[model samples]
Structures are given as structure tokens and as C-alpha cells.
Target: MTHPPTTAIRHSPDLEGELRAASKVTLIGMVLDAVLGIIKVIGGVFFHSQALLVDGIHSFSDVASDLVVLGVMRVSRQKPDQNHPYGHQRIETIGTMVLGSILIAVGAALAWDNILRLIQGGADQVPGWPVLVAAAASVIGKEWIYRYTRRVGQAIRSDLIIANAWHSRTDAFSSVIVLVSTLGAMGGFIWIDTLAAVVIAGIIIHIGWKFTWDAVKELVDTGLSPEDTEMLKAIARDTEGVRNVHELRSRRMGHDILLDIHLVVRPEISVSEGHQIGMQVVSGMRDALDNIRDINFHIDAENDEEHPPTSEQLPSREGIRNLLDEHLGGLPSHTRIRLHYLRNKIHVELFFESPDDAPGLDAEQITRHLQGYPWFGSLRLWFGAR
Candidate 1:
């Protein structure tokens, strides 16, 4: 199970910078898609090229998706509040899902149109050099936007932007189909134009499915890869007082990671020392991974897996103290006692101050006396100097 980090994790400037970069790139893409889409639709109608017209519709869809990206990026940058402790990173994931669904719907409609056209035979008009020119321009424009948007997306770790980049790249490929089919139609093979539209539809559906499938996986809290989990485990294991590390888990929040782990330390240490070890783990992980927003550390005295709980039939502290006094004359009133229950037995530790001249039973005698009790696990006798 996951727990909150020891410290409140805020969205750092790096994430803000990434969002800024993505927004700017997407805005530029929207402008290019609008202009290119208008050009393709007008030219397609004038030259009677159905393939080019469908490609134009695809470009328009990119414009719509870019608008979604711009809107989501704004809300996703909001700070965490009482209502949403994890901030708004999942907004981007949801935006990606919406974008993918839109792409699929648009592609399905285009495919259905083309399929009906193909079944009814081919259009009579031949596409001229004008249609080919528009397709070529679209390929160049959309591909440039694809590369630029993808670079920005990677820099900011924005999945929505990256998905949109692939959407742009799909447009570029679809334009290539439009260009090829336009050339074939000009050569008197008119049916090829409709067939190319069908091909473009298939490509759109494939890319759309990929984006949707990935977003769904993130929504379900899919963990990091095994290799990444091992890397985090290694970081915790290398901490100063951590003897071992286990139960390490991770989940993604935009570009950042939320982690949960258990740090094993020697059982004899104090609570403060265990906390210090946990701090070491937090610092080590923060230094190792820039995008780690939170880590929950659970300190273990020993491997709980190796030593399960036993039946609780042991005597209470007062009962044990009475047994000690009854067996060994008496314990000093100022004595400090600690009890450790382990492996189905009780280990006793007692501390008291004794002057050099004072007389009392030695450590060996105390151990010998406590050994008679079947429930006794071990004994520690400490007499401090006066």
C-alpha cells in the first residue's frame, strides 16, 4: 500500500517550464493545421480529389485536438488543494484520452465515407497538379509541426502533447497517401484515390487506439517497469543504516514518480536513529531522481517475513517485575526496564546505577537465574557507574 511522503511535494519550476514549452508548441501547431486544412479542402474540391479532401478533414481534427491540449495544460498546472492532494497531472492523461477518442471518431467517419465511395465505384474527375501541390505542402507543414511538437513534449514530459505530435505525424503520412493516389488518378487510375483514403483511415485508427490504450493504463495506476523498481530499491539499500530494502513500489504522476518502500535496520537502534535512516533514504532518492515527488518510508527492525507474530500468552511487565523481585531478592527502585518480544519469547533488559563499593549479583548470575523461566528469551543487565 502507498502512503504520503514525509514532506509535502510541490510542483517545481521544471514542471511549469515544461508546461509552458508544450503550450507554445501546441499553439503554433494549431495555427499551421488551420491554414493547411483550409488549403487542402479548397484545393481538393477544385481538383475533384476525395483523398486530399479527407486529408484536409484530418488536419482540422488536429486543430480541435490542439485546442483541447491548450485548455488541459492550464488546469493541469494548478497547485494541489484540499480537494485534490495529488495536484492536476491526471488532467493531462484524461485530456489525452479525450483527444484519442476524437481521433478515432473522426477516422471512423472518414473511413465509412471512403468505404461507401469505393463500393460505388470511382469519381469521374481527374485530380490535376493543383491537388498534388496541396498534398505535398500539407506533408511538409504537418511533418515539421510533428517534429517540433514532439521535441517540446519530451522536454516537458507531457503525454498529451506527445500524443498530439503523433497525431500530426499521422496527418503527414496520410498526406503522402493523398499525394500518391493523386498521381495515380492523374495517370487515369481513378479508383486509387478512394483506396488511398481508406488507407489513411486505417492509419488514423491505429494511432488513435495506441493513445487511448496508454492513457487507460495510466488511469489504472500502472506501476513503473521492474528495472526501474529495482533501481529505486538499490538506492534505498545503499543508505547508511538501511540493512535491506523491500516492498518498493512506484506510480507515475505526469513526469514525476510516487514511491513506497520499507527500510530494514538493526533492531537495537533507537527510534530517532531509524528516523535518521529514513531521512537518508529520502535524500538519496531525491538526489538520484529529479522527478520523484514523494517517498513513503516504513522502517523495520527485522524482516517481519522471517519472524511472524507468536501467541500472546506472556506475562505483563508488572508480573515479570514481581517474578524478578521474588526470585532475586529485589531490584533497585530506580531501575529502568525494557521488554522485547521476539520469536515467541520475552527478552528483558534492565539498567540501574551502582557505586563501585555497592554489592549486587553479577551479569552471569542474573542470566543463570532468568534461564529457569521457560518464557525468557534473553537477558541484558547494565549497571551504570555512580
Candidate 2:
């Protein structure tokens, strides 16, 4: 038997608040990136600092990425619809990948331009002191934005936002490189500025690759870590009435985890008891892991993982009742009948209101006759109040 999954499409209570937080931070970063991008680019051209020029382009890339983050946050927070029952969380993953791609392209183009200039003889003149001031301002501003964005991302448990936060940090790091290279140029080594631009490009490409790969893993439905999977299994096994746990699977949907497991219980337990055990397991898992969004569980009379499933041709309840009637010369009226299908056979239990109802039913004779059937396992009879 399988417990139906809980209503899986409902939105979290704090989704609106999370969206607002994400949007507010992203907009703030965008404004900063635009202002810095303009300042560093114009300053690089007038002051003759190639490193500053590249850092300016990197800031513009941040502006574009911030825009992507804003759009994705809005779409990813949307409620699950009829066509997409799992909600739009994967949209955030796609958006992150796109942002990474943008970084890669921008970094590669800038790096290639600087390398060409270096090959053909570096910059004609040393950069002016104003480039130092622009780079310094970028370092301070980008660092502040990085800290702010990271705080919001952690609060919301958003991977996309955190990845964007690191993107901002990278900008700050690149600006630091610009400052060092500008100093070296002013001290009579102009080659350092062009070389620093190459180094900054490499940093951007490395971060871009990490973000892209992480998103790809999520999109492909990667399972949780081995430690986490084992912890979940331990919780299921600890629940009372559970004989064993198997087939525990998990995947991520944005910041939430989706899980399903198979639970084994005593073969004779009532269906209600089995269902209750499944519920307990679900509750236990949720208590231990806050990110679990949904769990689907299957209740088993026997461990299907260790034993072959009962054949489809095995008699169902109606068929078994009919067979019993034919072989027993009409079964006595019973208050309830329970059937346990396990290990490729059926065990039957019948409860009668009183002994008189069964008349002279011979247990040995009935057993002898039913044992001839391929699916027969065992039988038990109960009389009096059941």
C-alpha cells in the first residue's frame, strides 16, 4: 500500500518575504554596479590603466547579472500551477547558469583583448594616480554589496542568491588586483597592469565554471550527500513498528528537498497500523530536516527489497473468497477477513461472531484442500469478540 503524498503544490508562507528580500538586494547591487562601471571605464581611458578598464567591464557584467537575478527571483517564487506541479524552482537554477555564462563570455573577451595588447607591446604610458582612487572606490563599494547580498541569501537559504553574492565578491577581488597593478605601473613597471587584467579574467572564469557545474548537477536530479541520506535512513528505522527502511530517495527543488521511501512492517499488522507507521516516519524526517518539502512513502507487509514480489496471478481477496467457498463447501459467515500477501503466497485470517456460525468446519480438512493451491501460505481462525 502507498500513502498518498501530501498536497505538494502549496507555496511556503514566507515565499513573498523571500522574494522581496532577494529583489531589494539585487536592485541595490545593480545601482552600485552601474555607477562603478561608468566611473572605472571612463577613468581607465583617461588615466591609461588597462586593468582599471577590465575591472570596469567586470562591473558592467555585474549589472547584467543583477538584472537576471531580479527576474529569476520573481519567476521562481510563483506558485505551482496545474502544468508545473513542482513549482518554478528550477527556473532559478537555469537563471544561475545563464548568469555564469555571461560571466564566462565577458571574462574571456576581456582577457583576450589584454593578452593581444601585451603580445604587441604593453600600454604606451603609465596610469595616472586617479586610476588608484577609482579602483579603491570599487573595492570598497563592491565589498559592501557582497556582504549585504550574502546576508540575505543565507537568511533565505537561496543558492542562486548566494552564488550572486560571490559574484559581487569576485568584483571586489578584481578591483584589489587593479589597485596593485595601478601602483606597479606608477612605480615604472607598466607591464603589471596588463598582466593583472589577465589574472582578473582567470578569476571570473573559475567562479563562472563553479556556478555552472553546480546548477547542472541540480538540474539532473542529484541526490543528497551520503551522510544526509544515511541520517534519513536512521530516522526511519528508529520509528516504532517499522521493520526496516529501503528505497529511500531524495532530490532537491530549489532550497527544498523532496524524498520518498519504502517502509517495511510486520506482515500481520492492520493496514491502518502500517499507514500510521509511515506517518510517523514522515514526521520524524521533517522534524530532523527542515528543508524537506514533500515525502511519499510505501508500506510493505514484507521487505520487497529482500524478497521477490508476489506474482500478479496470485488471487486477490474476491478470488480467494470464491476459492474458499468452493473448497470449504461455502465459508461460514465471518465478521471480518484479513489477507496478507507475502513472499509469493497469501496468509488468510477469518473472524467469526461465534463458534456456532462455523458449524462443524474441520480446520485440518480445509487446510489440506487449500494447501494444494500454489498461492496458499497459512490460515488462522478467530472466534468470539474480534
Candidate 3:
């Protein structure tokens, strides 16, 4: 009934702006990649170097991938409507997978072609100092492009941009091999060009496989690193209004994070008080990370201890409701509350105005004053409570 995702905090305006800028940067790279690809393709066709031609094809694929990123970004920005509830964040990840898959395919093709040529004992020789110079210039340019793109992607936490940046890096490395092969062909060693081509293929294949692995894992709903999960869980547990946390799942969508956490509070907690606590947890999580955008905290009451003594007191519904009223006394009457039982766990839900409103704070100094009460299991938060 509930699932928590590998979620991150909402991004700041600067972060959002940064991501948008990243998309723009991708378009720029796409243009550059396209131009370079065309040039290399023509040069390779005339000079007859399979390595340069393959590199050109790789660049062409990058242009296509950049287009995918642009499309995904545009769609992802559209506000969620009736057709989609969780927002369109995953579309960005889809872009990354598309790009990664393309890279891998290009790499495999290059590798296959080289293997075939080597087996046939035949390879073309493209002679001239101009080709080598051009390749060296391309290598330098591409490497710089890689660094620029990579820095922006990391700063903005954009997986698509990061993937695209690495694509440039592969291109740069591939060009280096191209340079070597060009020089080797002129040095009277024909096999050197073939060997360099093979190396270039190997490099491309490695980049493709690595990029694909990251993209595919996210597409499949894999959790975040164990360390990050533990840290997030700890933050939720220690935050006010969350008695216990469960069903905590975290998953990545490109550079973004989505989270769903079940929060536990005392069963007697009022709608206002539980909502307050949920808000606190959300704030805590938001404060903990810079990338989190949404928090879905499901507030519920903690169940009573197992094997309760016959003489021990059990909270009455009226008493629980009274406690909730006392905690959330200032809230408007329109607030709604829900009750649920899961695996014998008792929980009470309270709809509050906003998590930021601390109604009972006129009486307490600490953040978590009543999370230990027995009437609730957890408290979770969601924006625009209905």
C-alpha cells in the first residue's frame, strides 16, 4: 500500500536554474558534435580512414542523444495533470538510458568492424600531416568540452548531462587514437593504424558499458547507495513527529530523487499535531539534501507493544481523539483525519494546515517532544493535503 523511493530534497532555485542551463548546454554540445561529425565524416570518406569515420558516427549518435535529452527535459517540466500523479521526473532518466544505449551500440559496431578488418588482414592507410594535426586539434577541443560539460552536470546533479559529457570524453579519447593511427600510417608501419583502431574501439566499448549500467539501474528502480539510505532513514527517525519509519524506499530518476516514507506518531496524536510533525520531518529531509523536490510522508499512529499486560491501560478512541485535539487545538475544524491498521499496526492520520505550523509549540522547547507516545506508529507528509 505504501512505497518509499530513493528520494532527494527539493532543488533550490539556483539548482533548478542550473539544470535548465545544463539542458541548454547540451544543445550547444549537440550542435558542436554535429558539425564535427560532419567534418570528420567527409574527411574520413576522402582520406579513407575507418577510425575517423567511426568517430564521426559516434559524434552523430551524440547529437541524437542530445536531442533526446532536450525532449525529455521539455516534457519533464510540464506540471503533473490527471494522467500522471508522481510528476514527469522519470522522463529525464529515460533520456539517459536512450543516450547510453546509443553509445553502447556505436561502440559495439566500431569494435565489430575493427575485428573484421583485422581478420581480413586489410586496413586502409590515410597519409598526410594535415589529418594528424586536425585529429590532435579535435582531441584537444573535445577534451575541453568534456571537462566543461562534466563540471556543469556534477554541479547541477543532472545524469543526462553527465552521460553526455562522458560521451564527449570518449570522443576525445577516440580522436587521440585517430591521431596516433594517422601518424603511424605515415611512419611506414601499417599495422600500427589497425592496432590503434582496436584500442579506440576498446575505449568506446568500456564507456558505453559503464554509462548503460548506471542508466539501466535507475530505470529498474534500484535503491540508492546503502549509506545514503541509512542516512536518510536516520534523519527521518530523529525528526519530530516520526515515531518509527518503515516502507522507506529510495530510487533515482536521472539526477532527481523521489521519496515515500511512512511516519509513526502516537495514536492519540491530533490531525494538527501529526501534520506538524510530518512537516518537520519533511523540512528535516529537505534541509538534509539539496536535490529533493517532493516528500510523501504518510502519518500513522504507532501500534501498542506486543503482548500487553492484562492490567496495562489501553488508549480509548475518545481519549486518543482528545489528545489529538489538545495537541492541534488551534487548527481549523475542516481538517480531515484517516485511520488505518497494517500488520496489526494502529495509526491515526491528521490533516493540518501546514507542517510549518507548530500549534503546541507554545508549550514545548524541543522539536520532538511527543514522538514516543504509544498511540501512533509513524507520521508521513505530502504536499497539498486533501
* Top candidate, metric TM-score: 2
TM-score of candidate 2 relative to the true fold: 0.90
**Which segments of model 2 are wrong by more than 4 Å?**
1-13, 114-121, 332-334
**Model 1 over residues 285-308: C-alpha lDDT tens digits?**
888777788777777755666677
Write the candidate numbers in order of decreasing lDDT: 2, 1, 3
Candidate 3: residue 259 Cα off by (Å): 1.7
Q: How far out, in Å, is residue 183 in model 1?
A: 1.1
Residues 1-386, model 2: lDDT tens digits: 22223222222547789899999999999999999999999999998887788789889989988988999999998887898877888999898888777767766876898788668866667889998899899999999999999999989878889889988988897888788777776787756766877888888888888888888888999999999999999999999988898688889887788887888778776667777888888888888888888787887766767889768788888998888888777876654678877788888887888888777775676689789988898888788857
Whole-model lDDT, model 1: 0.79
The residue-by-residue lDDT of candidate 3 on 1-386, one tens digit each, is 22222233344335347657777788778888888888878777777776777778877877877787777777765566688655666777777777777777766776777677667764555555656665776788788788888898888777777888888887887787777777777776666666666777777777767777877798798987889888888998898657788657777765667787777676555667776777788787777776776667776554324323222254555565566666655435665545454444435555656655544333232214335565445554333477
Among the numbered candidates, top lDDT falls to 2
Model 3: lDDT of residue 208: 69
**What local lDDT score does residue 73 receive in model 3, on the 0 to 100 scale?**
70
Deviation from native of the Cα of residue 259 in model 2, angstroms: 1.3
- Identify the superior model by TM-score, candidate 1 or candidate 2: 2
lDDT of 3 at 8: 32
